[model samples]
Target: MRIVGISVLCLFCAFSAIVFFTYYRRNSATFSYDIVLPTIFGNSTEFNTSEIKKKRRAFVVNVFASWCTVCMQEHQTWKEISKRTPIDLYGIDYIDIEDNTLAWLQEPDNPYIAIAADYSGKAAKAFGLREYLKLLFSTKKVNWCSI
Candidate 1:
């Protein structure tokens, strides 16, 4: 009876762990540290990571690769979202060739208010991304028209 009770408790713990981990992994949408990424276009400069956060009530940072088919399909959804919402969207081009990303963005309505490059994936690591991430909720405001 003692051995059976212990086994049941262990099984319950395992199940609970699985559920917790799955939820935590899926819902982690913010980061505590700053992520300064370089621009793939124009002057090759890094943008003010924290200052952008001060202006807007909230923003979304999307991780995408120029080569990912899912990202291409989801791009349309982002375009639609941009049309309906006032929230700004930023793009993190993940480990992709800069030229290819530039062309890719040109084909779309360009929903991102601005885009930053994560060539070495440091920004993605800072954001605690364990896998391909669609959206990461953040706060920021900027005159992206000038970027």
Candidate 2:
């Protein structure tokens, strides 16, 4: 009985430690702007990571899909933020159709100064983005915007 009790306690502690580590790892993950992806622009332009890094201006990279309700809800807030802050806003359309994304932006205001298409989801994967809506901020230190 004593041996069984000890084994159960050890298992519980191990499980708890795993949960804690996973939570910490997920929340503490950081994203960098060193990635370069093609833009949605007609000019065949791309998101110039080197230029952005050189400028060192604080900017926001919003990863969203046209079909995501949470993203749509946050769109207004992004527009408001753009008006108030000097930060440049960019959008990454994650695993979405370009036509749908364009049509969605047409009805509402586009807060993004530039838009990129992540049709293959590689950009999203590279950034370690697991959520439908993720806002990455490029500053002196790279961080994820909670809002």
Candidate 3:
């Protein structure tokens, strides 16, 4: 009976841990660090978190690649948002070639106020980008934007 009780308790603990982990993973902000990235213009810069807090209520960080079809599709939307909104827009060129990205930006009127280069995708991983996007989009704010 003692052994059975211990087994049951262990199982219950495992189940509880799984539930708690899932909830935290889904709901919590995974990236809790300042992000700095290399700029297309050959400079490294930090995301203006303080500026965004003071000036714009929010900012969008978009992770994009020059070769991404989905990114191309959404380019116009980003442009319009930048033009019309009070929110700040920033871009991360995720694992993209510099020349290709510059060329891509040239024709369509670059919408981003600043662009960051993430050649190795380390920045994207640090940001927990996939989960962050889910959280941002799920928010009540109509202006869902980010890299």
| TM-scores for candidates 1 onward, in order | 0.70, 0.72, 0.66
Could you give me the TM-score of model 3 versus the true structure?
0.66
Which tens-of-lDDT digit does each residue in 75-136 have in candidate 1? 99999998999877778898899999999888747888778888898777777666775566
Candidate 2 residue lDDT tens string, 1-147: 999999999999999999999987875575444678888843448876566667778988789999999998998999899888899888889999999898888855568888888899877876768778777777777643434
Clashes of each: 1, 0, 5
What lDDT would candidate 2 get against the real structure? 0.80
What lDDT does candidate 1 reach at residue 79?
Answer: 98
lDDT of model 2 at position 17:
100
Query: What pairs collide in candidate 2?
Result: none
lDDT leader? 2
Model 1 poorest ten-residue lDDT run: 138-147
Q: Candidates' lDDT values, in order?
A: 0.75, 0.80, 0.68
Least well predicted 10-residue stretch by lDDT in candidate 3: 131-140
